[model samples]
Target: MSKKQHRGWGVGEQAEQHYLVEPRHLAGGGDVRHVSEFLRAAGWTDQSRTGGPLVFDSPARTVHVAYNPFVRPGGWTITGKANDHEPEWNVTFNPQTPVEIVAGFTDALTKSRSAHAPNPWAPLRQHGWETERAQHFTAVSPDRNAWLQFHQTGEGQAHWWAGARTEHGRTWDAVLTPSTPMHLIEAFSAALADPQPVMRPRGNIPPSRWIRTTSVSVRPSELGAWQQARISAARAATWARNSWASSSPRTHTPTPRPYAAAAGAVRTGR
Candidate 1:
């Protein structure tokens, strides 16, 4: 079969291009303060606002996300500290749920097929979507493949996920929204593509009315290592589940103050 050639430059690989809301940058230094102030004036608390890409108001321009060299420097610096400057801002998504609107834009802009298709290229997303890059949005699944393969196709620059918060001093600048919705779809798509088996059966007959049970045996010599690996995998899964669970926008749950509690204990000389 003839290979499918992309018509032009192909869809934007950047994840921010998929966000639904406009997550604009506030420049750096004073600009950060200004955007924070703007959100405050709009009745958003410092704890509620998020930092991310600056989706341009214009359509002709391809959306670009800014990266702070100090925070995440590219390539080896030859010598000296890797990244010296603290991260100024990142293309983060706000706590807004159901990234469908942004996803729609992403689907419109990008040429990425679902993660399951025959030609699966690595997903291109904002740098911080992975655990190592982001302060908050860590990879939920243990498989890094899902995080790596996901991409976003959207308009604007960034999004302000509503009701989201970050570990950075409860500042709105800490939380950010992805611009395109397609990035989320890509993440989910890649996750679905994982080699793990589905609990449901594929046969034409409906599932049995009752649950079935089976037993298996393993070599005693290998049991120790096997069990250890299983335990580790379980822990990873639990962490991923908890991470995304608490981030749900629909929950409206109050954030726990573990930091505050620790700080209070220290102050009281406990």
Candidate 2:
């Protein structure tokens, strides 16, 4: 009989692999009780409750929820592992995390574990952003004047951009990251619906207010013609101005030339 070689394989190694396979972070304000309830509802076993951090165990994972003294306004750090492994998965929730987002994370985590797949964007999708591609999505406000875009980073983090065009043709834009609270996104969406100007991040300029003015919405196919008409009008105005500027009193102001006729040519598609 051949002697069997003994290679040391242990629980710690399995735990490390499990954690490394799917790591996620969710940060903002949240309630511990809500988190605890969520864990219980997901069927995680209560392991240790006697001190430092509350512990929960799953068939192949361990979780710890503890108060983070270093975070302001008091926050909790939730960590997960395959089973007491090194380099555990961590997510922090601060005071700014809404209750709905906390619940959404729990649902996403549960789905990920059972499906054997990672879906970190579940919460965002639930909030009405339509996915365009993997980790990319766009949300347009009802008025069509404002839009929000989300782009996921290589590390599975998220980047956000919000833009709005005012009635006067001025544009406002902002770039934000996951570290910013979700409430800000909601606020931006609301501001886009109304006429109020959104404050830009870097400048001392005042907010851009929209004026109720006459506007025209041109179709993409008709844009060229509209542009040509505007160009003709500009040229006519320049010619009239130059003619008047170069003329003496004897010129009689060029007999009030037909400037509108030239502009009307393009508008009439002639």
Candidate 3:
């Protein structure tokens, strides 16, 4: 058999010439406040100090989520700090990333997980992304438009990155620092792997000559149903069942927050 050649670049990868009507997770991540709202729903209190990064605290005030929108690059820096037992970590999302994509990270924040070191790439594989070792455990999205990677130094913490590209070149991306908790990254990976075509405005996306945008004309349409083949598949936490009664999902459901209660404000000595 003759080796397949891609129109643009990479191993067996053809240039993404199809215009994505509703693209992947690059739709300027939704309302910034929605994250705080989700934290509240997951039982974390919003304790942001005036003129400071937005703050969210666990009921006992042991864990804090700090979000600053004014960093040098002009995006959101959401950091999870553990004054108790939760690991201290940081996550960043460029303004162009979709909120749903970011939620893939935040949604994972609620799950109960074990202590064994996590394999963030597993979720990518489960999402049908192909993987290989090339300086890192790299996984390419099924469409070849997006990529996620993970690697660790000798006995050191792991680092992570997720990004999507257009024929024009790289657009939006995220960085998860070593201090970040792994399962959180896992959840994020799952979210990125989801195949659902999110609704996006035509002009909001990059100048792409390769993609075409199509709108949903009906429910249960073949395109809609086919797009959700992997989306409806479940990716709950590793060792525990969902922690609470959540609303029905149009698609992916966040794992349960078994560790905390409603985000009602609680004052405690740190």
Among all candidates shown, the one with the greatest TM-score: 3
Ranking by lDDT: 3, 2, 1
Whole-model lDDT for model 3 versus the true structure? 0.58
Number of the top candidate by lDDT? Answer: 3
lDDT-superior candidate, 1 or 3: 3
lDDT of 1: 0.25
lDDT of 2 by residue, 1-270 (tens): 111111343433321100000000111122354445445545556665565454555434655545443445444445555343233455554433332333334333432223233333343344443445546677654345445577676776766665545445524344545543343344334322332221111122222332111112222323334334433443444345445544333221211211222222111100
TM-score of model 3 vs. true structure = 0.61
Q: Worst ten-residue run, lDDT, model 3? A: 261-270
Provide the overall lDDT of each model, using Cα atoms, as 2-decimal numbers: 0.25, 0.38, 0.58
TM-scores, each model vs. reference: 0.17, 0.31, 0.61
- Pick the winner on TM-score between candidates 2 and 3: 3
* lDDT per residue as tens, model 3, 1-270: 111122223344322211223345444454555456566656667777788777777555544565666675656566776646566777787866766677677655644454567877887788789997877778998778888887666667677878888766777788888777777787788778876544433245445654434422222232333333322222333112344444423333443321121112222111
